[model samples]
Target: MGKILVIADQKDSAIATGRGLELAARLGYSVDVYAFVYAPLGRLKQTAAERNALKQRLLEDREAEVQARIDKLSREGQKVKLKVVWQKDVAPWVVGHCGKTAYEMVVKTGRRSESIANTSTDWQLLRECPAPVLIVAKKKWRRTQPVMAALDLSSRIAAKKQLNATILSQAIALAEAMDEQLHIICAVEVPTLLEDLDLIDSRSYVAEAKQAMAPHIKALARQFDLPLKAFVVKRGPVEKVITSQAASMRAQMVVMGTVGRKGVRAKLIGNTAERVLGQLKTDVLALKP
Candidate 1:
């Protein structure tokens, strides 16, 4: 694995450094902490212009606070090198910076009070960044906790197969690194259109979905050397089923995937990944293929 780009958003919420650092240590990935200051200088146009020294002092103070947070985490015996970058316009900057390096993953605190109309920087990065993203939760978890991997066997796109594999592989690796159990789940829900289309049977579709996912689940189990019991198949909208599965299993983290590049229905429909994220209270490791 390469270095991980950690977006330290102290302003949004307390940086969940423990989970991020633990993940980096397990993956053996160096951490580059990017702490962006959102507060404009002096918070007033006239004050910023007249009180240049005061503005400078404020900027320095803000940077110091962020640096202090990073320093505190770095000292806790994490075997990862840590570096920091401070700037403004954090989200767009981070998205652009992703193209400059081959970072294995981008870790950040999940956006606060997020909604369709009010999406946050983390959501933007999840949609745009080239690297995989790990949205750490405010609630901390033990170093070793169960993780659930969400699988969608009904995707028609050829690339979805690659995405599923990437999701499972990372989840498996993390489970091994932390000495935690990895649960694989396939959530199937018949779409509303299924009833409208001719020759479409909801019950039969559910059965076929399970049948289709069986081989892939079995293959992943063998590859990861996981027991058959680790795999599960659920029926419901992913927003409900994925979270329900994770909660039931007491998973501290969930590894899933999103479509990075836009597609035909991308504009018309909200990302299912976002819906799942909204429902879960645990940390999420998102990947793109």
Candidate 2:
């Protein structure tokens, strides 16, 4: 495991910090907590005394809270380092710094609702950040439960195999570290036109897909020397199918890879992995390739 950076803001720092520490402890990784503060330049243009006073107060407040969180984690047997950054562009700063650093993953909490036209900094980080992002929603995180790795077998990109494998491996390692179960899932979406034309038998297609995925699943099981739970193959919107399977299986976390496609094409066409992140009720360990 590499360094895990926890990105937080003034309002959500405590929860995010705590969650990051927990994850680092489970994964046996070094943890660093970062808080981004918006320090207005206009304020700096004010009287020297006023500017100094405001800067001093902000620094003192941020330091106290950060230290408290770090101390709490230390008491819990987690060694965490904290840093407070005064920056206007939180998302860009994270991306730039992470690109230069050796961090393998960035962990943060996700908001419930997002606007169609605008998104939160966390959302932006998911779309554009250089490092892999794990967004933990507000719920009881099951440290010792099954993790579902959702895959798209039909992706045109040949690189997907490597990306998917990394996702699955990480999920399995996490589960093993926590003494939990790991399940692999693939959503087989049959186009409505093909179904209507009867050109492809949906049931047969699903079966064939499952059969093809069997070899990979078995290989993983053999490598880990663990019994492989049944592989799931369903026909529907990939996002819905993945979420339903994870929920029905009572998975603790959904592991998957983001294709990194962007703009109107990605939005109009939609990617299964991205859509699942937006809709899943459980925490997501999203890898970028």
lDDT of 1 by residue, 134-233 (tens): 8877754344369788877777677887788788888888888888888888888878776677558888988988888788778767876778787788
Write one digit per residue (lDDT tens) for candidate 2, span 53-137: 8877887788787787678654465667778877777778888888889776888777645555655666667777888888876
Regions of model 2 farther than 4 Å from truth: 41-45, 75-77, 140-144, 197-199, 223-230
* Residue 173 in model 2: lDDT: 81
lDDT of 1 at 175: 86
Q: How many backbone clashes can be found in candidate 1?
A: 0
Give Cα-based local distance difference scores for all models: 0.74, 0.73
Each prediction's TM-score against the native? 0.84, 0.87
TM-score of 2: 0.87
